[model samples]
Target: MRKLLQPILAVALGLALGLAVTWIAGESPWHVLKILEKGAFGSGYDFGMTLFYTTPLIFTGLSVAVAFHAGLFNIGAEGQLTVGALAAAVVGAVWSGLSAPLAPVVAVLAALLAGTIWGAIPGWLRARRGSHEVINTIMLNFIAAGLTSYVALYLLKNPDSQNPETRPIGPGYLIHQFGIFGGAPVSAALPLAILAAALVWVLLWRTSLGFEIRAVGQSEPAARAAGIDAGRIRIIAMCLAGGLAGLVGVGEVLGNAGKFKVGFSPEFGFIGIAVALLGRNQPAGILAAALLFGALHKGTADLDFETEHVTRELSLILQALVILSVSADGLWSWMKERRRPVIPETAGGVTC
Candidate 1:
């Protein structure tokens, strides 16, 4: 429990710190709050958008969390997500004549496979050649950036449309709608995201495979001594992480756009690291963090609409602050000790 509390406390402290920074910058905290409220929860439309925005974040956050559990940093999630999206887009366009069920199934599978391959590159480099995943994944990001753009701009460009996107996907591959919520972009992916989270939790906590991964993550040498294949485990963990990130493409294409945009992702994979940190890498915490980010994404528009005084860029500043504070707990601990508030018992992990 102690593992979880410290991070939560750190975020709270960071939020206060962000507010202070905003104040010093001549912006009122109230203005910040107003912007958040306006963007996130103003109406059913806003709420729907919040859920919509959360789709990619949920999968991406789990991607990082899973890799972290294996003691590896899958910074290549951005590339994985992009490649997966590209794969899905291609499949979506090619299989347009098939039955809806088969078309979406193919597209989603292609996305997963592409993501797995993308993730495996870094994993393979790290395990076999002893290359740092951080370096390889960062490099992969550029490769994906170049490749995805090249294809989108040339090979996949829509023939008749002015937009830089591929041909429209089949209706079958599109995310199902509540229909009740008109044009909200809320799709069947919500339940899928939740299911993915549950599966991840069960895989990490209940399954023997999860135990193997965690054991390696806790300590590679100890895991090797216990007869576990550390390198294999790392590779598997990264593949699964890639698959999870690829699901983000499913959520975006099948659920939101129903087609692929060349440059759709605005660093959802990168932001996921912050979400995982805020949640302390726990499933419940990850969900909460995703929702918080979703709300922030949703509310920023409202915040800007209600009060044009502060730009949405300020929200980015706050996000960075929260991440810094959560990652650095000593500052929060000292402050908590100073305030003398009883720290609530939490699942605070020992590694911190």
Candidate 2:
């Protein structure tokens, strides 16, 4: 219960702080709250848009969470997703003649494979060469961005448009959007994202590999002592994390854009770190955190038009505050634990 209660309280605190900032900025807190609520859920279209924003976050959240379980901080999710999205776009456009069903499947596989390879490079470096994953992942993000830009601008530039984007994929590559969202681009990708979350939960909780990963995360020395190949587990966990992050392309390319755009991502990968942290790196918690972020993103879109003082940038402030709140909570817990008196054990049984 503390696990759940803590995050909820942290969120509330963050929201309260954010709203107070708005009040100080000469906006009524209540008015801002109403606008946020309305913008996020006032209509089916709005809600669908929120889900659309959410789909990729789930993928990235799971990606980070998976790496976290293996004691890895996957800062390279942006690069992984970028490479994966480009790979999917390349396959979808190059194989335009491929029939439906098979087209998306193959493209998605390309995405996963691309991301896995990208993620593996850092994992292998960390495990074999003692290179830090954070620095490697950050470097890879730049490489991925440059590589994708070169490919899109030079190799597969759309002849029809001057934008730095790939050519449109074949119709077969497109996924169907749900009509229930009032024509919002909420697609089959939403269900796929939810399914991915469920599968992640099962993998983390119901499998031996999960235990090994968690064990390695808790203490590499202990895991090695227990005869677990900690290095191998790290590589496998990173590979899985990359594949999950790669699924973001499934929604962006096949579901919405039908092509790859150079700057399509609004830093979903970076925001995912906060999602994983807020969710406590658990799958179910990640889902809830992702949805909250998605709603915040969608809700803030209207602030510029509706409020005199508040702007969409408020969303960034809100996100930062929430992350700070969670971090402070964790720090407080750690301090409390450290200050707690430990009962000593003696050879006989207990020691005073």
Candidate 3:
């Protein structure tokens, strides 16, 4: 109950903060709240859009959560995702004539391989050179951005198009969009994301590798003393983390965009950190948190037009507040501890 209630309270606090901000800006908080609700769920189409936005968040959230279990911070999911998308696009474009089923399979494999390699570099550096994963991952993100941009602009750019994007993938590689909900761009990726979440849950709870990862996270010295290869486990965990994040590419390139766009991601990778934190790094919790964020993203789209003062930035503000509230739990607990009554010590130095 505490676990459930904590997240609920955090979300409530975030919403309240957003409402207060709205009121201060001279907007009717009630009207904005109603607009958010209507935009998110007024129609089936709106709901589908929410789900569509959620698919990639699920992948990125799981990626971060997996790394957290291994006591690693993978801030480079954005880089891994970018390279994975490029790989998928390259494979799909080059092998456009392949059989329908085989094309997507090959493209997905390319994405996984690319992401795994990108993620492994940081893991290897951490294990072999004792370099910090945080610094390495952050550096890799800039490299990936530049590399992908160069490729999109020169090698992959469609001849007749003005946008700095790759050529469209083969139709055979494209996941069919579900026309349910009035042709909202929801695709097969939603079910795939759910399956990925279930698979991650099983992997973490039912596997020896998972045990080793968790053990290393809890106490690396103890794991080393017990003859577990903590470094190897960390590297493996990082690879798996990257592979999961790479699936975001599959959703975007093959599932929705059909090409690798230069600026397709709106910091989905960074936002995933909040999702993982809010979910407490649990798969089930991550799914729920991702859905909430997805709804926020979809619902806030119309704020610019619907209200005079409110804008879509309110979503970011709300997300920031939630993250702050959840992350400050330790501070709150420490404050409570400071306020607790102290028992007097006896002459024997024992406290009553």
Candidate 4:
């Protein structure tokens, strides 16, 4: 229960700080809250859009959480998702005469494979070459960006459109959107994301590989001493993380856009870091955190029209504050330890 309360308290602190900022900016915090509430849940369309935004965050959050469990910070989920989405788009656009289930399944597999390969590159570097995963992942992001742009612009450019997007996918590649969303593009991807989260929980808690991954994360040297191949675990964990991030493409390309738009992602991969941190790298917690951030993203859209002093950028500030507040938990613990009274030890080595 104490562990559960930690994240909740941090979130509350962050929200209080954000509202105070709003007050300082000459805006009524109450008005801001009301506007955000209305913008996010005012209509079925609004709520569905929030879920739409949430779907990708779930994938990316799981991606980061998986890598975190393996003692790796996978900063390249953005790159992995970019490459994976392109792979899905290319497969969907070029494949012909395929049936419904087969077409979508093939495209999704392509995404997962591409993401796995992209993630594996850095994982291999860290495991074999003694290179840092963070640096390798960061470099991969730039490479993925440039590579995807070249493909979208030259290789598979939509001839009829001037936008930097691929050709439209086949009809069979398009997933079914829920009518309950009031014509919003909320699709079967939402349920798939939920299923993925559940599967991740099962994988991390109910498997030997998961045990090895967690053991490696706690201490690589100790895992090595226990005869576990730490390098292999790291690589496998990263591969899984990348594949999860790649699933974001399923919702973005097949479910919503039916094409690969260069900037379709509003940094969902990056926002996932915050989600993972707030959730304490737990699957169930991540789901809740993703929804909260998703609502914030959708709700802030109305700030431009509804509020005079506050804008959508306020959401960024709020997100940053939330991350800071959560991070401060470590510092708070350290401070408490420092202030704790020390007991003197006797000559016999017993505490006095």
lDDT of each: 0.82, 0.92, 0.88, 0.90
Candidate 4 structure quality by residue, lDDT tens digits, 205-268: 9999889999999999999999999999999999999999988999999999999989788888
Q: How accurate is candidate 2 locally (lDDT)?
A: 0.92
State the local distance difference test value for candidate 3.
Answer: 0.88
Compared with the true structure, what per-residue lDDT tens digits does model 2 show for residues 255-346? 99999999899889988988999999998889999999999999999999999999998888898989898978556665565687755644
Q: Model 2: residues >4 Å from true position, as ranges? A: 329-331, 334-352
Query: Where does candidate 4 stray beyond 4 Å?
Result: 334-352
lDDT of 3 at 99: 63
Q: Which residues of candidate 1, in runs, are more than 4 Å off?
A: 1-4, 332-352
Candidate 1 matches the true fold with a TM-score of: 0.91
Q: CA lDDT of 330 in candidate 2?
A: 54
lDDT of 1 by residue, 1-352 (tens): 7777777777677678877766776778877776677668777887788888787888888999999999999787889999998889888877777667777788889999999999888888888899999999999989998998788778877787888887777787886776655578888777787888999999999999999999999999999999999999989999998988888888788877777787788778887898888887877788889888788766765544565456666567767888898887576566656687555563254225
- Candidate 1, overall lDDT? 0.82
lDDT of 1 at 322: 81
Q: How many steric clashes does model 4 contain?
A: 0
Question: What does the lDDT read for residue 103 in candidate 1?
Answer: 76
How many residue pairs in model 3 have overlapping backbones?
0
RMSD of 2: 5.0
